[model samples]
Target: MPISPLRAEAPPMRVGLTPVFLDDQVSFLSRWRAWLEKKLERQVIFVQRGSYREIVELLLSGKLDFAWLCGYPYVRYRRQLKLVAVPLWRGRPLYRSYLIVPADDDQSRSLADLRGKVFAYSDPDSNSGYLYPQYLLTMQGENPSLFFARSFFTWAHRKVVEAVGVGLADGGAVDGYVWETLSETHPRLTAATRIIGRSGDLGYPPFVARADIPEAQLHLFRSALLEMATEPMGMELLESMRLDGFITGRPALYDEIARMAVRVGRL
Candidate 1:
C-alpha cells in the first residue's frame, strides 16, 4: 500500500503598516496585532515601515501580504496592488488636505496667499500632507520651489503641525484628520496653528494587498477588517486609531489623486 503524502503547513501572513500615526501609540498597535492574529487564525507577522515608499515597495514586491498604505502610493501603483478596505472617518471614507499657518498670522487667508513663505511638507509620498498641496500649487502654475521661498519635509503630519505652530516654518501642509485628533489629545501642540485652507473631500489611505494574493486569504482579511467595528477588542482598536469602521472601497475613490499626479506632471 502506498503511504499518504504529508501536508505542508502554510507560512505566516505578513502585514505592513506605514508610520502615519503617533510613534507612542504602542498599546493600540499591540492590541491590533493580537486581534489580527486571533481573527486570522494564522501566525501574523507585523512590519512597520517609516516611509510610505518602502512599505509600498514591500507590498508590491510580494514581501508583504498586506499593507496599510497611503492613497498617493496606492494610486501610483494601482496596477500592482488591490484595495483591501478603507477606514471610515466621521462616517465616511474621506479626508482633506489642510494648509496651516501660525495662529497669530494675519497675512494669509488662503494657500495662495502664503506664496513666497517657507513651507513644511509632511512627507514626499503623503496624499493630504504633500501631494494634494503640491497639486494645488501646480493648478495655479506653481510648484513648491517656485511658490515658496524654501520648503522642507517634516516626515510626519504631527511634526508638520509642530514646525508651523512653533514658527519654524511659515506654513505647512498636513492631514486634517491627524490635525483634529492632535487638537483633542495634544492641545498645546496645535493651539498656535490655524488652518488656512482645506481641500474638498479626498480619499483616505487604505489597507491593501498585492493583486496576486490568494483569493481565500484576501477574502478572510477583508472580511475581518470590515467586521472590526462589531467586535469588542476591535472596537477598542478602532477607537484608538480614531476610525469609525472599515468599508469595502472602490478604486474610483483614488481617481482624484491620480488626476492630481497628472496635473503636476508627476504621473
Candidate 2:
C-alpha cells in the first residue's frame, strides 16, 4: 500500500498501524488488520516501516492520520502529535523492561555484574525496550557504552530476547509485556530466557492522532477506542494484543520520558 492517502474521501476513517516488524510478521499484521477493520468501524491499513523513527517521522510529516507509537518517540514529538490513548496491560498504566540473560548463565546476577559484558538494546525510540533500560544503567553510576564491551540495536524486542537466549550477547533488555506474552504463548522462546533484573515501570505506547486532525474527528476516534475494551470483538482483539484495557492519555504524562531522554543526551 502507498504510504499516504488512505482514501479519496473521508467516509471510512482510514487508520494506519505500525507493527514492530511487519516485514517478517505478515500473518500477525493480517490478523491485526482484520480485527481492526471489524471492530474499529474504519478501513484499517498497516504501514510497514524500517524503524520506530520512520514511523514517528511519518506521523509528524502528516503522511499518516494516526499511529501507534512508543513512549520515547511520542514524548519527542508530542508538540506535533496529539495523544489519544494507550493499551493498558494487566490493569496497569505502565509496563517494565527486563534485563535478561540465558537461564543457565551464572556469570551475572545484577546490573553491577554486567560490567564489561556485551549488551543488546532495542530501538532507540522504544520505552520499555530502550529508555528505561538506559535509565536503570545510569542509575547504577555506569555509562551504558562503557560498561558493555559491545552494543547494538535490534530494533525489535523479540530479537533482543533471542540474542540473549542464544548467548550472542551476555545480556539485553526486552519489554516486560512482550516477555510475559511470549512466555504464555511461545514457550520455546521464553524457556531459554531468564530475567536477572527489571527497570521501573514505564508507560506503554499510545495511539496518537496528528495535531492537525479535526477536533470533532479526533473526539470520535477517541470515543471509539474508549469503548473498545468492553465490546465482545474489541475484547477479543485486546486479548490478541495482550492488552487488558485502554485509557485516555495526554502528552504531559510523558514528560518523564522526555526528561530521561535529555539526561541520557538522546534529546
Instruction: Give the top-scoring candidate (lDDT).
Output: 1
Task: Name the 10 consecutive residues with the lowest summed lDDT in model 1.
Answer: 1-10
Error of 1 at 57 (Å): 1.1
Give, for candidate 2, the lowest lDDT window spanning 10 residues: 1-10
- TM-score: which candidate is best? 1
Q: Please provide, for model 2 over 1-267, each residue's C-alpha lDDT reduced to its tens digit, 9 standing for 90 to 100.
A: 423324445444545554332235566556656655555555666665767888787778877778878878887777898988877889876777788988778778886777888888888788777787687778777787787888788888888888888888788888888788888777788778788898766777788888898887778777767777878867776777778778896666677778888878787
Candidate 2 Cα errors over 4 Å, as ranges? 1-28, 38-42
Kindly provide the TM-score of model 2 when superposed on the true structure, using C-alpha atoms: 0.88
Question: How much is the lDDT of residue 259 in candidate 1?
Answer: 92
| TM-score of candidate 1 to 2 decimals | 0.93
